[model samples]
Target: MPAAALKNKPLPTQSTAKRSVLFDSPYAPMAKHRLPAGRPREWYVTHNRRLKAMRLAIALLDSGVYLANQAHDETIRSTAEEIGVHPPSNTTCHMVRALMRYSR
Candidate 1:
């Protein structure tokens, strides 16, 4: 089976009515205010990149390698330090230490 077919498979039906008080209220007509514009916000791009870096850092840390040996380690650290508003937590520091030992 192809991926598209699997996704199109019928879902089980529920017996109860799927209703929301928000939709039934007079405010429903003005709910357009709740919808987001279909464009990426600046913060979204920044946050997404930060999340990607963090994930990569965690993977490196898990592999038990020194970050300095990795091609992108310096870039990751520089970007993280620049973008990060606060210092990493104790857990994050511990993970970095483990990676350092592994690299050695």
Candidate 2:
């Protein structure tokens, strides 16, 4: 357990170890949580839009588009298409740019 004794040992990683059987099973029961009730329809729509925008923003950052101005509506929409998501609307594109701007 001494530091010097452990220096030559490599850390365990996913590829080097066997995971639990539960995780490897195809029939394992997955947990699903339902959203809370009573919210307006528009609230749900906007919430999903926000989530999508956030995803697109992060994708743009990953692809080297850091500035809000650099991430135009067309760029955001194209990124969404590349990532297998539907093209974002103008409002969602604006939200994505806003998110990039404030994230700085």
Candidate 3:
């Protein structure tokens, strides 16, 4: 992908084809954090900070502050720790990788 290719694209909309593709593919897995059996019906809080952290990580990597393969895990771990969110482990990384592949 070229830098120019992404330069003028509008921000993605929720109903975009990419989202449809995600929902239709194997990348769309069940949520890991579901209410247990017999649990009261309650809304789970959205962790907006997690998305922020991911965006930050992506930005830093794009800016050449960190190599994609080198220090990526540690950077994610440290950033998550700073934000008090548990860092995703290898399993989560694998899922993310699959999702990225599907999106591309």
TM-score of each: 0.30, 0.67, 0.29
Query: What clash pairs does model 1 have?
Result: 66-103
Between 1 and 2, whose lDDT is larger? 2
Report the C-alpha lDDT of model 2 over 9-86, residue by residue, as the tens digit.
Answer: 343222211211111112222254675789998988998899889888877787678899887766776667555577
lDDT of 3 by residue, 1-104 (tens): 98886765343233212111111111222245644455434322224333444543543344334444433455445433433355667544443334333432
TM-score of 3: 0.29
What are the lDDT scores of the predictions, listed in order? 0.39, 0.69, 0.40
lDDT per residue, candidate 1, 1-104, as tens digits? Answer: 88875664333233121211111111111122332557568766555445444543543444333354442434334323433323444444444444454545
Stretches of candidate 1 exceeding 4 Å from the true structure: 1-40, 73-104
Kindly indicate the candidate among 2 and 3 with the higher TM-score: 2
Alpha-carbon error at 28 in model 1, in Å? 37
Error of 2 at 16 (Å): 42
Models sorted by lDDT, best on top = 2, 3, 1
lDDT of 3 at 23: 13
Displacement of the residue 77 alpha carbon in candidate 3, Å: 1.0
**Best lDDT goes to which candidate?**
2
